[model samples]
Target: MLRLLKVLILLPITAILVVFAVSNRQSAVVSLWPLPYEIATPVFFLVLAPLILGVLLGGAAAWLAGGKSRRLARERARQIRTLEKAATTLPAVLS
Candidate 1:
């Protein structure tokens, strides 16, 4: 089921990407100032490279931001386990 869902989602996206790449086959020049370096590549590459890089960097930023919450959760889980152990060793209170 999961496989089918992924195929359904990915197939169209793959087709679109293929069409986009084919349509944007014209060469584009990329250069950086303060450096003597330049390369000619596909137009689609110029657009897609930054987009993919932004996605990776954004994901990393979000993961880093969540570290404090994850750490607190782990601390809470440890405290709960400790309390459970201590409770098991304690005498039961009468109702």
Candidate 2:
């Protein structure tokens, strides 16, 4: 199911990239170096910059969040086990 969803989401992006790559012969007006520049629209960063930055940011955030949650879960499980052991031993010790 996730694979299908991934394909569906990526299909349009793949199509757009292919279209841009193939249609790069024409130029468009763009800004560069503190001025509006005329460059090949499909050949420019408009086709790549955001994708790169988004991937980097998304990867970093996922890593950071996943690490924290995994650590918290481990700590919670350890605490639960410690409490259970203490509870089980206390009755025998008191008797």
Candidate 3:
């Protein structure tokens, strides 16, 4: 069922991308400042590159932002384990 849903969603998107790439097959020149070399690529690639880059960067940023919360969760789990160990040892030591 999940696979069917994925196929339903992805099929149309893939078709659209193929159409877009075919329609925008013109060459585009990308120039970088302070560099002597420039890249000549397809218009579809020029349109898609920044979008892919943005998604990657945004994912990285979100992962980095979650680091603190993840760390806190680990620390909390460690504290709970330590407390459990201490509690388990207490009765033996007392007896």
- TM-scores for all candidates? 0.70, 0.50, 0.66
lDDT of each prediction vs. the true structure?
0.91, 0.82, 0.95
Residue lDDT tens for model 3, 23-93: 99999898886998899999999878887899899999999999999999999999999999999999999
Candidate 3: 10-residue stretch with minimal lDDT: 46-55
24-47: candidate 1 lDDT, tens digit per residue:
999988887679998999999987
lDDT, candidate 1, residue 31?
Answer: 89
Over 4 Å off, model 1: 1-15, 33-36, 91-95
- Which runs of model 3 end up more than 4 angstroms from their true locations? 1-15, 31-38
- Model 2 Cα RMSD, 1 decimal: 5.1
Candidate 1 RMSD to the real structure:
3.7
Please give the TM-score that candidate 1 achieves against the real structure.
0.70
- Candidate 1 residue-wise lDDT at 74: 100
Error of 2 at 61 (Å): 2.1
- Please give the lDDT score for candidate 1: 0.91
Candidate 3 global TM-score: 0.66
